[model samples]
Target: MDQGTQLLLILVVLLVLFLLAVIVFVLFSVFMKRKNSLLREQIETEKRYERAIAETQIEIREETLRNISWELHDNIGQLLTLAKIKAQNIEGGEEMIEVAETIGTGLNELRALSKSINPEAINGQSLIYSLEQEVNRFNRLKYLSADYELLGDAVTIDSKVEIVLFRIVQEFMANTMKHSRASKLEVKVQFKADALEITALDDGVGFDSENLFEKGIGLSNIDKRAELIGADAKISSIPGAGTQLKLIYPLE
Candidate 1:
């Protein structure tokens, strides 16, 4: 072969090698990008699954607590009421009267203890009733006022959801009575096509929630509760302005 031809042949071979190198590099980049993307997707899926499991466990615990509370309120509470009546009617001498007084004290203690553990602190007569019945009893309490409003029928929900909603309201009412100076309080629930919104507004001496508390168990529990049902919860508060918690949950 002539010298010029030989040089030309080598140039062509070098060009082919460079093109092959470029092709390999491109394929490698694509493979890496795809692998990274899949890994990210896998991480997200795992996080979602973890959250779901936690929510499910929380719900189970709430149901167990509720069932026990119901048994205490219904069966045990009724027996205490009957005993109280019987003791009140009993007649006897001074010692007997003293014994009756002791019995009366025991009955009162039983009732109070029942209130503490009884689910809802006041049982839900039906899905139609709000926590108002339970809150009413607290009305007589000084430095505390519980108010309620309605927009639609408060139907039955998953027992866990009900307890969460109930506890959120309970905590709010307690906070108001303990910290709020404003007497006016509002509790209302509005149901949308796919979600339920609950508003608990108190005109109490509102604290600077913006800076005061970040994530307390009370609020965290509420959020965790909403999360269980795949719902979203938002809390807005300001000093001298009451706290507002909006929970959005699907109807089903």
Candidate 2:
């Protein structure tokens, strides 16, 4: 072949090889992108499944609580009332009067507990109303100086989110009453344009928020549940400064 023709042929071959390399690179990039996209979709699907299972479990738990509440209100509460009546009727002197009074107090407590645990009672009303009932019960039972305040205008919330929020507050309150030795508790609900904010705090001894899992407080599970509901739970605590949980739920 002539020198000029050989050079031209070599240039054409080089160009063709370069084009083939580009094609291979493009195909590899597209394949990687698709693989990554599929992986993300799979992860999202697994998360959705997990959330669904968790929600189902929560529903079952609430149902059980409702049944227990009914038992307490109807059977146990009725029995207590009957005993109180008998105690009041017997002429056992001042001791009998005190006994009757005590029984009456017990009956009131049972009624409060039944109402608190009943999911229908909590879900049948507004979130504010349900929370108000909890705060009132605390004050009535002298469990603590509980206070509830609402900020901004009240907004309608999904029933599922409302129940989860209420349960989270209930768990925190129970922990405070049973372990925190807190004398005062405060709960605030704020309705903003874009979201709902709930804050619950107790003026009691606090623990390390960083090591919450080590303490087995179940607040971690609360965090997970909040995420499942597309809410954010931020729990903070300092020794002697008490504990606080701030939940932010987006309004849809």
- Give per-model TM-scores: 0.58, 0.84
lDDT of 1: 0.66
For 4-28, candidate 1 gives per-residue lDDT tens digits of: 9999999999999999999999999
For model 1, the superposed segments whose C-alpha errors exceed 4 Å read 1-22, 60-64, 67-79, 91-147, 150-163, 177-182, 192-195, 210-220, 223-241, 249-252
Q: Judged by lDDT, which candidate is best?
A: 2
Candidate 2 collision pairs: none
Q: Write the per-residue lDDT of candidate 2 for residues 183-225, one digit (tens) a residue.
A: 9999999999999999999999988999999987667777876
Report the lDDT of model 2 for residue 50: 87
- TM-score computed on alpha carbons, candidate 1: 0.58
Deviation in angstroms for 181 in model 2?
Answer: 2.4
Worst 10 residues of 1 by lDDT: 121-130
